[model samples]
Structures are given as structure tokens and as C-alpha cells.
Target: MTQDGYYAVQLNSIEIPGEFDISFLTRTSNLKAGNIIFDSGTVMTMLDTDVVDELVRELTDFVSLPTEKPVAPHFKLCFAVRSTEQEEELPALWFGFNGQSGNLRVGPDKLFVWVSRFVKCLVITGTNDKVQVFGHITQQNFLVGHDLEKMELSIIEKDCTKLHEP
Candidate 1:
């Protein structure tokens, strides 16, 4: 319940299988500002190109290498087109993070919405095979934990920069 809308989640070990080549994520409009984030990102995702390289080399434990053909990474933008009705007026918005994109696409959707808007996103590409999870749109504000006997993740919705680590 912080200003950035952060919540407590168990940072358990997760395994994304076949994490190679390109990753894909589906962003769409129709999301409300008062609604929860990252609510529609439980499916496969894609990364642009440069974002992929940086993400792999820094964020997670992945390997980067030289390639014959390099690609520039991009991001995704999703929104909604509100109308008068709900089902009869489903106005959705989703577009690739490519810098050259214009209007929202309308046709056979490319991805699904299973991600909440509560986490920072980055494009991660490993081995230059396929791009994956570029980055979410949200940023990770702060995470406070205690390691007395077990790891405990709590919700700290306040200002606490005086306790930052160097």
C-alpha cells in the first residue's frame, strides 16, 4: 500500500524452462488505474534486443556472447479503450516496445495478460538464441527483509532511505 503500489510476495525459487532465444509478453489496454498491477503476465514473453543483453549480463545468472546478427531490444505498452459498455465495448490497448510503433494493433492478439503492474521490467536474452522477459513496466521501489532464523519478506510502505546499504 505504498505510493508505488507495492505488495509482499514470497520470493521463492522459480524455474523458467527453455529460457533461450526470444521471450514474449502480451500487453493490452483496458486496465484501470485503480486496479492491481502485474495482473496479466502469466504467459510467455519476448524481449527487444539491447535490453536483453543488459538484463542477462547484469540482473540474473545468464551468459552473453558475440553473435553474427545483433538485435536492438524494445519494450511493450498496453492500455485500454474504454467505451460505454463492458463486453459490447471492449476497448483494449497493446503494442510492442519497438520505437517505431504507432497505434494499438487490432487483430489476432499476440500475447496474453497474466502479469501484474507491480514489478520493474527488463528484457533478458541469453545465448543470443531467443529473447525473453525484457522487463516489466514497473520498478521495484524497495524490499525489506529480516534473517533472524528464516527469511521474512514484509511490506514497508514508508520513507526509509537512512537505512540503505552501501
Candidate 2:
């Protein structure tokens, strides 16, 4: 485990669909890398840029909102993603996190929601290894749960307004 305590799990043959399904493998760090390289806190789960691209196309007219944190350039999408499970969608949800000042805050100001269905990534020079990242997307979407022993992420569907914020 890295400093933050994320267990590197390798998922293979994952299917990402938006009418057309793409098969690929994925890795996460929650931080940049890990003990050997770029690392941060645990509970790292990231989606590919290809997933982000798909969301942009499928979820047309997505309202772009301004963010205080400068994780990525340009505006971020402020909405939660859901599978067409049934007639009713999940409720709103928020990710509660300690701010830079150690104070907790929540919503359009604190977090932005993004889905894997809206991302795309191509080959960049020297990037023949694999596309991977800790990501602002994961940080914005999940709430880390730790008991000084085990760490896990739970899905919240309270408001689903943005990410985690009041």
C-alpha cells in the first residue's frame, strides 16, 4: 500500500458503453502515483478521458459550472451520473471532505460531478504504458471511509446535486 493506503486493484475487460462499448483495463492511485512515484491519499479510483468524452456527447446540454479548485483547466460538469435503472433516478448526493483549511464544506462550490461515459484519451508520446491517473474526477466524486485499518468508498445518493458541498 502507498502512504494513503489504497489497494491497487486491476480490472480487466471492463465495458464502458454509450451505445458503443469500449473494452479496456484501468488502474487508480487516489493520488498522482504511489510510493514508487506520484502518490497522495488513499481510495483512488479514476475514469479514463475517453469516458469523459462520451458523457459530453450523450449528456448534451450539460450545464457547466465554475469551480474554486484549479485541478483542471476550463469549467467542470456539475451533475451526477446514473444508470437507467428504472423510472425513478437516484436521489441527490454529496461527498463530504475536509477543505484545505480543515473545515468541511459541500456543492457547486466544493465539488463537480463527472461520469466515465464522457471521457476520451489518445496516445501521447512516451505514454505507451497505459493511461492512468489519480484524478480530480475521483476526488470530487467519492468520500473516503477509513477505520485506521480498512478503507472503502460508498456511493451516496442524497442530493446528487454536484459532488460534496453545502
Candidate 3:
């Protein structure tokens, strides 16, 4: 948690271009410490407008499918997939924290959603607001633990359905 009462974390890096292993961390100043906050109430992750624009650009170039406007007003990027299998064409995206050894890997299942039968959009949106939110969509199926005493947050993927089993 941050001193400002936000559950914020420092984003160390982002892996967007999978095959080339390229990171935009050095290219942008928006990836600053304590810029991202975890918010369970928000259904979709929201980044700064500038950050989202850059991501949209990269994604538009990377994804071979035809692009379209999202049916919803919030989302800025959408793609038309021929079938569920075409979702595999999306490259992997990961968000790494300052001190964490494992990056939060977000696959197509977690990253994209079908707004319509043929159109799928990124689960992330751009916010002109002050705070950038790491929403529940990306945090799905993960057990997130916050240690207020140590001011730390831990996230691990789990089979949520079997969590209550002995």
C-alpha cells in the first residue's frame, strides 16, 4: 500500500512484444513507481491515456486481425477474430513488479474479451482520471494477499474453484 491510501505497486517492466522480447519501459515515462493500483471494484484495468495510446499502437501493429472500435465506450482497442483459435495469435503480456521474481502473466483468456460474436477487445481501458487501476479482470483466478504490516502485496494464480476443498 502507498502512503496516499492506495494499493499501489511499482511497475518494473512490461512485456508486450513477445517474439522480440521488447519492453517499452525505457521508452515511456508513464511507467513510474506507484503508478498502478489494485482495485477489485473495477471490472477492467485502466491505464493513463498516454500509456494506453502507446499500448494500442503496439497492439494494433502486433495483432494481424482487423481492428475495430469497441462496442463499449471505455475500451479503445478491439480486434475481429475469425474463431476462438485466432486468439492464439495475440502475444503474451506480462506485468513485472519492482521486487517480484515472477511476472504476472496475462494470456488471451485474461487479457481479451468478446464484446460481440466476432469482435474481441482488450480488457484494459484508458483513463483520463488521476489513478491507474489494475482491475479484477486481470487479477482473476489469482489469490492476492496484502500484508499491511510489511506494506507488501503478493499475487499468485490458483484454481479458484478448488480453493475450498480439503
Candidate 4:
């Protein structure tokens, strides 16, 4: 846990690639590695403002959907989807950490949340100066573990619901 009470991890890079084309966006090469906190208490992921802006711009260009002002104050990008079916075409995101751990590939199901029957908003947002927070929405379906003795964190792909089944 960090001094601020959030469980933070060192991040190496964040990348978003076109689902079917060549356009891509990446934020890496930080002079000092950035910290990304995994916060279960928060509902959406928060990244540095510049990173978020670039990501939003790239996604907007790729999808090209008519935009609507976000009803929620925290959301900056919200699109009007005719149906949930439209979500199938959004771009894919890859989050890479600083160690030997593999990259996390995020699909639309984990990346967006339905605001209403017609609106589905991306769960990622921007922060001004705080370390990035990886919220619960993006952590779904994974079995996460922390080891204080070793000062290590481990995340494994698992069906969390069945963890305690007989």
C-alpha cells in the first residue's frame, strides 16, 4: 500500500492499438517510472491527463462516433451507441508493467460501462498530479494477490466468482 492508502505499482507503458488498422498510441519512456495504483474502491481507471487526452483522441479518431457530453462529471469521453453491439468495434488497449509480468490486454467488455440502454462510456479518465489509479472496473475477472513479505504483487487471470466453489 502507498502512503496515500492506494495499492500502487510501477508502470512501464500504456498502449492502445487499432482493432483492425495500423493507428496506435503509446506512452512510455518516462524518465522516472510512473506509479499506477490498483484501487478497488474506485470505479474507473485514472491516468495522467496528457496520456488520457492522447488516448481519447486516438480512440475518437478510430471510432468517429458522434459524441455526447458526459452526464457524469468525471467522464470526459462518452459516445452515443445505437446498441451494445456497437461496442464490438472499439480499439484494444494493452497495459505493460515494469517487470517480467506479461502485458494486460483490455477488451471492450472490461474497458467500457453502460451508462444507459443507449450510452456506453469508457471507464478510463485523467488525473492532474496524482499517481494513476487502476480502478476495479478494469480489474474484473482477475485474481489479484499481494505479498508483503516479498513486496510483490501478482495478478492472474481467473474467474473470481468460482474461487470458493465446492
Q: Rate the local accuracy (lDDT) of all candidates.
A: 0.26, 0.30, 0.76, 0.70
**Models sorted by TM-score, best on top:** 3, 4, 2, 1
Best by lDDT: 3
**TM-score result, candidate 3:** 0.85
Judging by lDDT, tell me the better candidate of 1 and 2: 2
Candidate 1 C-alpha RMSD relative to the actual structure: 18.3
lDDT of 2: 0.30
Model 3 misses residue 4 by how many Å? 5.1
Question: Across residues 1-166, which tens digit of lDDT does each residue of candidate 4 receive?
Answer: 3435555567656666433222112443222333677778888898888877877777787776677778797787888888556766665678776553457776777787889877778899988855677889888987777665665667887788898999
Residue 16, model 1: Cα distance from true site in angstroms: 24
TM-score leader: 3
- Candidates' TM-scores? 0.20, 0.29, 0.85, 0.81
Task: Quote model 2's TM-score.
Answer: 0.29
* Segments in model 2 whose C-alpha atoms lie over 4 Å from true places: 1-46, 61-143, 147-151, 155-166
Error of 1 at 145 (Å): 1.3
Superposed Cα deviation of residue 32, candidate 4 (Å): 9.7
lDDT value, residue 98 of candidate 1: 22
